[model samples]
Target chain A: MRTFEHVNAPDVQTAVALLGEASTEAIAGGTDLLGELKARLRSPQRLVNLKTLAGLQEISYSPKAGLRLGALVTLAEIERHPIIQERFPILAQAAASAATPQLRNMGTIGGNLCQKPRCWYYRNKLFECWLKGGDKCFAEDGENKYHAILGADRCHAVHPSDLAPALIALDATLRVVGPDLDGELSLEELYTKPTESRRQMTILGPGELITDIRVPIPKNGSRGVYLKTMERQSWSFALVSVAAQMNFAGERIADARVVLGGVAAIPWRARDSERILIGQRFSEGLAERAVEAAVAGAQPLRDNEYKVSLAKALVKRVIIDLCSTTD
Target chain B: MATKAVRAKKLKVAIRGPGKTAIKLTVNGETHELLIEPRRTLLNALRKDLGLTGTKKACDEGTCGTCTVLLEGKPIYACMALAIECDGKSVETIESLSKDGQLHPIQRAFIAEDALQCGFCTPGQIMSVKALLDENPNPTLDDVKRVLSGNLCRCGAYPKLFQAALRAADLVRTGR
Candidate 1:
């Protein structure tokens, strides 16, 4: 890893100020950042340690206030929290299925949400892909099995977070602190498609830091489920994951949100699928129609055509399972 | 609480240098002061500065659990952690499990069950199991499998390893 100066930020203000320096990055869990540094994908001049900042590790919840998760709360904590498991089961399941027990124990919520793409070409320092300011994406033509099937503008690399899809399904918002910006944005706004003007995945400013995540309270008779398919049983990134949350009025679905991961540059919200399910009676036929609508416009790459079917199957299974559950 | 306040005060003194910084680490109930660059990993500091090589290093990235250790009672990858970030923190390594030359129960179970073949991944596997058993004394088979999934055993001793973990749990319950 390239040598750099390290500073322990005393508070959020200090951490944001330290990040204002050129070529400086914040280190929360260091699980992803350390790997990038070792692979020479990034070489910042300074690292601002966010662990020293107080009060960023708390996880609080209330029936009226919903859930408030600090940026420093580890994935392990989220996976085991009783309130999270009971109130927002999709988040718990997503957290449990991510990485491994050890990595989850150290990786924080903020770091996980802001993690870079896991594209092998982008990760390999030798290949200067388009995301890294090169001519073109190598994965577009070569070894594109794991590339995105949706929202592939300039970069086809898929978003790697298992939690982002679940959080977006639950309508979570993020509170950020920066030199010029300090407010909340919907979880959907945190991500952006890679375009020629903006090559990065998120729209966060240079000195911005995520402080807290607020998940809205689940409505009455609401049910959620998160299902992920991987190459192996454990410790592998999701091949295709589906997060579904449905709010039912009596026996009819009143509202719904379905998001797909590992198939898009951002957490792909299946609005067509959600539209198909709303105000419809929960049934296998409804689930099939929703699943079909979910994968309607997917433009899979040469090697990733199988992902469309896999993603469709996952969405169908998750919707049926969630609809069958009782509140 | 007073001691914690004092330690926080001490850590508040930031290191504003353009080069290596001095920091103090508390590992295995011992405090060691070392000067290292910010990029130095906790795994390297443990092996080189403290000379505690029981923690094996593999994959250096966070993928492999060979560099697993306990940070504040939670198992984490040492290779992915910076030593400077561990200032004023407690770290438990594989070396600290045994006391007074007596093997820890988990170590004894591994030996009895022959859970290891080449033993390259033993320390990490044991540490992960120790962390699990420390929190849940009576873990179910599924719990053991889920927690140990991070520590890979290339020797394909997974069945015996699970058996050893179950045996360790039994021994703990009986106060052996």
Candidate 2:
């Protein structure tokens, strides 16, 4: 890692102020940022240590207020929290399924959501992909197996977050504070395709920092499940994952959310798939239909057409799991 | 760079180093003060400066768990943690395992179970086991596999490693 000045910011205001300067970035658990630093991918002149900020490490939940997770809360903390395990099991499952125990102890939710893509071209200093301001993206014609099948614009790198799809399915929002941005923004709104103008995945502006994640309490009789298919049982990124949340009223599904990861530039919400479930009764045939709609418009690259089928299978399994037995 | 960190309030939060700066680290119940660069990782500080090299540095990045250590009683990759960030925090490394020349229970169990080959990954593997048994005295086989999955042993002594973890649990329980 390059030698740099470290500032342990005493408050959010101070951290934001420090990040406002050029070539300065915020360090939260350093699980992701430190790797990027050591690999010489991004060398900031100064680092503002967000760990010193007060009140960012607490997790509190109430029936009326839902859940409020401080940005600094580690993934293990989220995975092991009693309320999260009992009430928001999908989020807990997602956290537990992510990286190993050592990493979960060190990685924070904010860092997980903000971590860089695992694209080989992007991480290697040898290739200057378009995401790094190059003329073209090598993943387009090269080893494109892990690239996105849906929402493949200029960059084809898939979003590598496990918590993102789960949280987005639960309709989570984030409170922000910064010199350029402040207010609450939905978790889905945080991700955007990397455009030529802004070659970054997230829409966060300079000095913007995520303060807290707010999840609305699920309505009664709601079922949520997160299913991920990886090459290995553990320590592997999801080849295709699905997060399905639905509220059952009597025999009909009142509301539904189906989000897909590892198939898009962002946590791709399957609204068409969700529409097939909501306002309808669960049936064996209905699950197949929802699964079909989930991957209807996917444009897979040469080596990644298998993800299309994998994604459909995962979505169907999740829908079936959520609607297996109605109370 | 120094001027950017100055603020009207919170004067106690000083900007430390583009160079060496003073910091305190508590390792194995002993506190030591040293001057180090802010970029110095805890792994290097333990092995080089403090002369405590029990924590191996196999894959320095977070992928390999050779440098695993307990910070505030939670297992974290020492390589991923900065020494400056560990100020006033307690770090428990592999060197702290034995007491008064008697090998720790986990170490003794590993030897009894013949759980090592090259022994390059033993210290880290033992530290992870110590962490697990500290929380869960009687872990199932699934729990043992999942926790030891991060610490890769190229020699593939996984069967014995599993036995060692279970044996270490028995040793602790029986006060051996």
Candidate 3:
């Protein structure tokens, strides 16, 4: 790892100010930043330790106000929080399905959302892919198994977070703090397609950081499910994951949210699937139609054709599981 | 709580540099003050500065759990953690599990179950089991698998490892 200065920010104000400096980066849990540093992918002159900040360290909830999580809350805490597990279990399931226990203990919710792409070409220092301000993306035609199938622009790297799909399905909002931006923004707005001008996954400008994450409590009789497929049973990134949440009014569906990961540059919201699910009761035929709509316009790469069928199957399974859930 | 209306003007943080800086680490209930660079990982500081090599380092990235250690009683990857960041926090490594001459129950169970082929991953595996049994005294088979999934035993001693974890839970429950 390249040597750099480390600063313990006394408050969010100081953290923002220091991060605004050139060749400086923020380190929350260091699970993601340390790896990038070790791989020499991001060589910063200074590291502002966000853990030293006075706030962004608590998980609070209320019946009327819903659940609010500080940015520094570890993934393990989310996986084990009683209120979260009992109320929004799909979020907990997504947190639990992430990296191993060790990484979960060290990885914070904010850092997980802002972590860089896991593309082989992007991570390898040898390949200056388009995301790195290069002319072309190597994953376009080379070893493109994990490339994007939807919303691929200059880069095809998929969003590698499991919590993103789940939280977006839950309609979570974030409180961002920065120089020009300090307000509530939908979690979906945090992401962006890798355009020639942006060349990044998120819209966070210089020194922008998330302070709080709020997930609204679902209405009564609502059920949500997060299902992921990996190469192995455990300790692997998602091959294709689905997060589906449905709100029920008596016997009919009032509203629904369906999001897919590992299929697009951002958390792919399956609005077509959700549209099919709204105002309809859960049934095998409805599930089939929704699943078909989820992958209608997918453009899989040469080596990633399996993701299309796998994503469709997971969408069907997630909807079924959400309707069948008793608790 | 800080108000959102407060604008970030200039930083008041005392910065430690690209050069060596002073920091203190509490390892195994002992505190040591040393000067080191900011990039020094907890795994390297423990092995080199503190001479506590019980914690192994493999896949220096977070992929492998060979460098697992307890930060504030929660298991985390040491290699992924910066030593400077753990200034006032407590760290429990594999060396701290046993005291005097008596082996920890998890270590004894690993020996009894013969959970080793090359023994390269034993320290990490045992530490993970210790962490699990510390939190859940009566861990089920699935719990054991979930906690130890991070610590990979390339020698393929998983079957015996599960048995050893169960046996360790029993040994601790029986107070033997």
- Candidate 2: lDDT of B100? 96
- Model 1 preserves the real interface contacts to a fraction of 0.76
Model 3: per-residue Cα lDDT over A1-327, one tens digit each: 988978888888778777777788999999888888998998998898999777688999999999999999999999999999999999999999999999999899999899888999999999989999899889988999987888787788999999999999999999999977789999999999988888888999988989999999998888888999999887787889999888887767899999999999999999999899899988899999999999998888899999999998999888888777665
DockQ winner between candidates 1 and 3: 3
- The TM-scores of all predictions, comma-separated, are 0.96, 0.97, 0.97
Per-residue lDDT tens digits of candidate 3, residues B1-176?
02211222234457786789888888889988978899999999999999999999889998878888988888888999999999878899889978898998998999999989998788888888888888999999999999999998888999999999999999999998
Better of 2 and 3 by lDDT: 2
Candidate 2, A33-99: lDDT as tens digits: 9888988888888888989889989999989999999999999999999999988999999998898
TM-score of predicted chain B versus true chain B for each candidate: 0.89, 0.93, 0.92
Model 1, A124: alpha-carbon shift in Å? 0.2
lDDT (Cα, tens digit) per residue for candidate 1, span A123-166: 99999999999988999889999999987877899999999999
Instruction: Indicate the worst ten consecutive residues by lDDT in candidate 1 chain A.
Output: A13-22
> Tens digit of lDDT per residue, candidate 2, span B1-176?
44555542344657778899998999999999989999999999999889999999987888878898999988889999999999999999999999999999999999999999999989889989989999999999888998887787889999999999999999998899
Evaluate model 2: give its TM-score.
0.97
Error of 3 at A145 (Å): 1.3
TM-score for chain A as predicted in candidate 1: 0.98
Q: For candidate 3, what is the total of clashing residue pairs? A: 0
Candidate 1 vs candidate 3, TM-score winner? 3
10 residues in a row with least lDDT, candidate 2 chain B: B1-10
